[model samples]
Target: MQGIIDRQLDVLIYPEIGMDPMSVQLASLRLAPVQVATWGHPETTGLPTIDYYLSAEELEPPRAQENYTEQLITLPNLGCFYRPWGGEAIRLDLGKLGIDPRSPLLLCPGMPFKYARQHDWVFAEIARRLGRCQFVFFIPEVTNLAEALRRRLEAVFAQYGLNFDEYVIFIPWLNGPAFDGLLERADVFLDTIGFSGFNTAMQAVEQGSPIVTREGRFLRGRLASGILKRIGLQELIAGSEEDYISLAVKLIRDGEYRDRVRKRIETERHVLFEDMAPIRALENFLAKVAN
Candidate 1:
């Protein structure tokens, strides 16, 4: 940027500005005449000349302005563009995974770092509310992190008077196809709090797996909510922590409601898969920024 940034470049976009020396130096340098940020970091860069912070309309909270310093540019009905990295969606038999065909399964899949301490109690409380239920969580990639999360959950469950060994099941991460298969069979997808999952939520929505989400004030926390909102599944999006618990429980207890939501999701899910409006919004933003 120090060498190439000049009057020739119309805009220089920083996808995410982490707390790193290089990003700070680059953002502080005003490398391009028009510098911008995006939803990657979900926070302000705080650099005076960093012109804009771009986010999708569906993913941003109403009071989003208070969270950022740059001029916020929101695009319509957009958040993530998901694609199959590898492997086709497979149909896995529950019997093979030691899962009973008749027992209900709740899938909680995400990174270890995204799992908050409070979430452990949430899971425990859910288990306490619904007896004779199984909560399945995907093992994190890192061995140590995976074990740490497992231990934390175990302790929390015990504290809540629920035996973790009897109620929780941990499945090691698998390839995309198999993972999708897991979603295909699961009853509900429990979203991560504070830091939501984008691609993971998309995959769950695509598979018609009912997800329970608590929308946050920040864009990062609203990633999955955007997907649910765009798909016309607002009923699945929880407004509060208690609402989240009720929604998840309802998805399990109310079979008819679950079926209605599942059917609606199956029919309305197409709209979220294809959206070209963001591209047009980008063109307009660039035209405006160029001037």
Candidate 2:
């Protein structure tokens, strides 16, 4: 705090305050004349000292300011200049990875905690609807939590008279080409319901994989929906849980439709990467704030 004061900073752009205890404490104090929060953690700071919340046009819903303590500044598009992950996609043998190549793979690539219990039935329902489909999950750093999540989902699948082991598969985390290959191989990418994925969704779109997402109530849950909206693929964004399941099933069952969506993604996905509008908006916002 003393160092910040000594520097006489005009503004403080604090990100991911929820992810760090010390940062939250610092954010609660008036370290600068203007303090702004962003969607690194994608929730309201709820601190009196924070003057503004930096969000994107596509990420927010109607009258989204009601959900924040700070005044919301909805920037253009996804509000970030993102570079596509430049990795060589190397296809791996599914048999060696203990996955059956015959079964259609549905990628659910969010952290285990993001899989809320209420949405657990989604996987089981999709499996019931598509009897031969398999859902792939990544075991994030929190290994025990991932295992716990698997157990929880197994219970849900059992209720539907589906064997979780047969339909659900959890593999170690992958990066670079491995992750890209997985996305490419997946028949459909299922975005987490309550909290959406920004980077993962972007990568999936880059891979031209069909993604089914629920446009969440808040920014945290609306990222993939925003991406889909930006690319004019609103049909892939679901308004309700039932719709989400149906979209996932449709993608898996109708290969032609899935191919159509993938081709659409290949055509429209260029607008999403290397965007400059968000950066220009930030610059303009900063100048206005500084004055």
Candidate 3:
């Protein structure tokens, strides 16, 4: 703290304070006259020293201030300049990967911890509704966590009179082209409920795969929703758990609608990538606050 004080910085912008205990403790002190927090960990710091919570306008719902202890400052259009991801995906045959081309492939690539127990039923219900489909999950570094989640999901599937093993498949995590190839093969990208996937969702968009996400109450949950909204694909964002399931099913079952969605995404998704408005807004905010 004294080192920071000695430097006499103009302003201090801290991100992901919640991820580290020591960082949180340092943020509690008045290290800077203007200390602002951004959405590395997407929740309020709940510390009095945090003067502002910087979030995106599209990311926050109406009256979002109530969820934060610090004063809220919303930047425009996803709040960052993000370059579109483009790469050569190494072609891998789905059959060899144990994925059936005939079955609808719904990708759920979020970490196991992001899968809330209450939302586990959504997968089983989707499987039941579709009659035949495959839900793909990536096996995390810790294999035991995946097993734990698999056990819970199996219980949920049993209630619906379906075998979890029949509808779900877990594959080892892939990198670069391999992962991109998997994204391209996906029929629908299922954004995790309660906690959304920001970069993964963006990568899915880059592949032009349709996504279904529930706009969460907090910033952490609303990332994919904001991305969809910015790209004019708000139809893909759901308000409730049932809505999420229905949207996922529609993306899978409605061929024409799905094509139209893909076309629209290919055309409009450019708005999300290489945006400078948010950067300009951020610069202006910093200048205004520092002075």
If scored against the real structure, what TM-score would every candidate get?
Answer: 0.91, 0.98, 0.96
**Could you arrange the candidates by lDDT from highest to lowest?**
2, 3, 1
Compute the lDDT of residue 288 as modeled in candidate 1: 90
Off by over 4 Å in 1: 1-8, 19-25, 79-88, 98-100
Query: Residue-wise lDDT of candidate 3 within 196-274, one digit each (tens)?
Result: 9999999998888899999899999999999999999889999999999999999899989988998998899998988
Candidates' lDDT values, in order? 0.82, 0.92, 0.92
Query: What CA RMSD would candidate 3 show?
Result: 1.3
Each prediction's RMSD over C-alphas, in Å, is: 2.4, 0.9, 1.3
Deviation from native of the Cα of residue 125 in model 3, angstroms:
0.5
Q: Model 3: residues >4 Å from true position, as ranges?
A: none
Worst 10 residues of 2 by lDDT: 90-99
Candidate 2, 104-175: lDDT as tens digits: 999989999898988899889989999998889989877998998899999999999988899999999887
| Strongest candidate by TM-score | 2
Q: lDDT value for candidate 1? A: 0.82
Q: Candidate 2 versus the native: TM-score?
A: 0.98
